[model samples]
Target: MFEQAYGRLVCFADGQREIIAMQWKQGATCAVHDHGATASGRVHLVVGALVEERFSFDGQRLCHTTTLHHVAPCTIEVPPGLIHRMTASPDATLTLSIHHYEPCIASMRIYDPEGRRTVIVPDDCGAWIPEDAAAIVAIEPWSAP
Candidate 1:
């Protein structure tokens, strides 16, 4: 259980989208995990720096890893079920980022080093703010009415 804090930035009910800001101190790391079946995500760095790694698994073994280093003002797109992990750089002051989820993340799976899987219900984290009716929309305007 790595230490970190989450703050809800915004959300839309009918549209099924949300933005959550996460704060991480030096040495912090997010557990390797996947977004829910219907969800995709994008993370935008707001402060300091961190690393993101995408992994592929064969049976129970991890393989084909890809990594990205993100500093403030950068963004990365993540597809649903894409096993990934994030870590704050050791020299970082503090890492802050806003995570965007589509079709809203209901549940996700966390993976242990041995490839063991644990279902994590997002609601259980207790890090959400009440949904606002007048928040800025997350979808692209080209698709809007």
Candidate 2:
């Protein structure tokens, strides 16, 4: 188990399949990120609610696509190569969810549209950039649809 700025993570499996239980605080938002190249996953909302912001990457920049609201007792399919960020709903003090990933995510790409930078981080680091990561400025600015 690990404690992150946004919440706590308890990893159940890390072999061919990865299962992680996460507890997020109200209003806590994860960095925009994508699953590893070939990895796909599902998020099972166990408690509270979440808001997901989905994005699409053009050849040059990342563009906002849609926003989804998920309540407890629901599941969200995360397709391969999908880029998104999740925020804990303010209506709940804490949100809990289980994330299942196949072929376990080895690394993730974090996009910082405002900073105009991107960083690749290990799965253990979640969507947030680690202190040791070196961000690379994007050649083109991000956009919203």
Candidate 3:
């Protein structure tokens, strides 16, 4: 959802769940999208702020219906079938989020209202970091299973 987003999959559980730390540069965003029927997740803001916009699909078109503004130290529950997009707060310099996904995040579906096909979510997890963070050392080559 970002032009140059970065992520590090910090944790994995049985190939069915994952914890990803994602960073968004200014003006970065994902297009309107859904997490798939079998997917559910949560986003915890760790730095800066963000603005989320939810949309509704009527088979013919997508309509914007809701907007949520969040700051650091907040949590957002992401239910399956939610069509939404997010961007770093325009006034903010950058944003960071810790994301928890059930059944993995590869199940994400980017919407295409003008066509029949949806974009397959890529497995790119961005750069790897190694450091003692909160008493846990990060692993290398972190990517979606």
lDDT (CA) for every model shown? 0.62, 0.77, 0.66
Candidate 3 residue pairs in clash (backbone atoms < 3 Å): 1-29, 1-30
- On a 0 to 100 scale, what is the lDDT of residue 87 in model 1? 79
lDDT preference between candidates 1 and 2, better one: 2
TM-scores for the candidates? 0.72, 0.84, 0.73
* lDDT score, candidate 2, position 26: 78
Model 3 weakest lDDT span, ten residues long: 136-145
Give the winner by lDDT: 2 or 3.
Answer: 2
Identify the runs in model 3 with alpha carbons over 4 angstroms from their true place.
Answer: 1-10, 113-117, 123-145
Candidate 2: stretches off by over 4 Å: 1-5, 134-145
lDDT of 1 by residue, 3-92 (tens): 343434454344678777777768667666667577788888888888888887554555548888888888988887788878788897
Off by over 4 Å in 1: 1-15, 124-145
Q: Show the lowest summed lDDT stretch of 10 residues, model 1.
A: 136-145
Clashing pairs in 1: none
